[model samples]
Target: MAANESADGSLRAPEDFRSSTCGDTKSLKKSHLACRGAVAIAAISLITAIILSSILFAIWGAAREEDPTFQNKQTENLQQCQKQCEDLKMMLHLATQDSRCRLCPEGWLWWRRHCYFFSVGLQENRRWKESAEFCQEHNSSLVEIKDDAEMDFLQGVMCNATKFPFLWVGLTDSQQEGRWLWLSGKDIQDHLPLVVQWDSDDRDCADLRGDGTLFAADCEEYGPWACKRES
Candidate 1:
């Protein structure tokens, strides 16, 4: 008979006693007021806690739901920053190192103290051996990627070129079957620390892709090749 409904649709019992003598009535009224005050404070605190928690959860959820385009833009920015850093390091190197340090020849790219020239606009693309000969004519050799940095650079640059998909490097297994060699006549395994991850273990020629990966190609594929020299 002394129940009350709270705003949250919960039933609660009033702390006031109905059966009280006149002398005890004032004390009961005082107790009732104190209990009501405590209940009000508790209700306000619970509602405040729920509101704060809801806001925090909404913020966390939105943070986790990142926009795909925004993520792509962030990736592009990171790549550009990396490229700028590399360029700065190259400038400092040219400033501090031997005077012989210089810009790559026309149509060439400079990376890690090496000059790379990607062949293009030829009357016709040459065979693997002829491509090597072309590099030899320039006092360089068909490019041999030496590290991950070099691989990434070559892949990125090629991706921007008008002509691409595959390009040649100074790698072959001509003299002996299954034993690879660089154009420099050194055993491929001995000269390069990384393994030649061939598309198949049976092919001889080496080709680089715009995606910065390697695959074995037919020795006579008509495509541009890269040349490399010390800078």
Candidate 2:
């Protein structure tokens, strides 16, 4: 009976030791699992921050691109408004013309309540001032340049005539060389017609060349000339 009791006590001690070791292993495994979960949560937070930063950067870039486009559209709208205002003023002037006007003479083209005459057959080429006097003989003056399109239209009319090789245009620097003043006393140096053949420095006078274009000419030379009048 004593031998049996001793063997049973030894077996019980070994069994108790195995149970304590198993409990320690289970505690270590639980700690490892908790550490892995913490690491995974940190990684997920880092990814979310990166995604938000990318979205913000894209929004800022898109706003920068749109700014210039919006300003360009606004400028276009302002220009259109200015053009409409000018057209309205012209229409009002036209409406008032009937109360104070009569028919223009023959051989004269009527435009903007004024009459323009082209003396194509006149043979005498005179100085610009002399041409102005010739037009005054018929109660008129030298042609006045109103705008770019009007000047271009006058150039086209002069070009059509084959009979007059050249004419004295009402543009000259006789009063002040290199400084052209129109008959209306408006500074025409800036608005002087473009010369197809530019002259040397000594040629200060202006005349319409044979090609139906304006050029500097000798004041004493003779050529056909243009005249203008108001209706």
- How many residue pairs clash (N, CA or C atoms closer than 3 angstroms) in each of the candidate models, in the order given? 0, 2
Top-scoring candidate (TM-score): 1
For candidate 2, the per-residue lDDT at 114 reads 63
**What is the Cα-based TM-score of model 2?**
0.47
TM-score of each: 0.49, 0.47
Cand. 1 TM to true fold: 0.49
How far residue 36's Cα lies from its native spot in candidate 1, in Å, is 88
lDDT (Cα, 0-100) at 114 in candidate 1: 75
After superposing candidate 2 on the true structure, give the runs of residues whose Cα lies further than 4 Å from its correct spot. Answer: 1-102, 122-127, 189-202, 209-213
Per-residue C-alpha lDDT of model 2 across residues 140-193, encoded as one tens digit per residue? 677766677667666677667675455565666666667666677777645654
